[model samples]
Target: MNYRKATEKDLTAIVKMMADDVLGKKKEKFQSPLPIEYVKAFQNINEDKNQELIVLENEKLEVIGTLQISYIQYISYLGGMRAQIENVFIRADQRGLGIGKKVFKWAINRAKEKNAHLVQLTSNKERPRSIKFYENLGFKATHEGMKLHF
Candidate 1:
């Protein structure tokens, strides 16, 4: 898999893959042609120094996976920086091809580059497979995750 920082041109493929999955199907909106708000969001992320939107391409140059890594500083962590991994998605056909491992390894390496004190992510409790996958990657679920959705 070829990994690269995403460009605005990648939004369509990113949104498509994001919505192609079960959970995303309910929450993500892909443009029948592309949306203005999505474009704005892409630009915002691109401009943010603390965020990176990554895309993974196959040999054929198709976008097969994507994720966002955000580096933030928290006083609770001794004012050290932490990296949060989010929106990880691999094309349905690309699952179990060792691509996920590569993607996550890439993210972790990136966190290290940023000198982050911690790297963390949250998987929906409904996805047992993802939990097991993360566990296999050496991530421990030591704390409960909570969220307040609007």
Candidate 2:
């Protein structure tokens, strides 16, 4: 597997993978030529030095997974940098292939390369299996995660 920064050309596949799950199906508008909002958001993330939108490709160079890591510099943790992982998704057909673990290992190493103090990610409560996967990856639910949607 190869991991690299996502390009505009990979947007459709990325969105498609994101929408493959039940939670994503409720939120993502995965259509051909996707909503302009996705394009605009991609532009913003692409332009930001601290934001990394990544795509995982197989040996044949087919995109099969996607995730975004945002490096945030904060005054806490002794003025450290934190890597926040988000929007992780693997193509439906690609599940159970251990691809998720490989991608996460890559992401963690990347965080280390960037001098981040820690790497963190949040999965929806609706996905128990995902939470367990993270736990298996050595992530601890050290704190309760709360969200307020507008």
Candidate topping TM-score: 2
Give the top-scoring candidate (lDDT): 2
66-116: candidate 2 lDDT, tens digit per residue: 999999999998999999999988999999989899889999999999999
Per-prediction TM-score to the true structure, in the order listed: 0.94, 0.97
Stretches of candidate 2 above 4 Å error?
A: none
Candidate 1 on 95-118: residue-level lDDT in tens? 878989999999999999999988
Segments of candidate 1 deviating more than 4 angstroms: none
Q: Whole-model lDDT, candidate 2?
A: 0.94
Flag clash pairs in model 1. none
RMSD of each: 1.2, 0.8
Report the Cα lDDT for residue 26, model 1: 94
Count of clashing residue pairs in every prediction? 0, 0
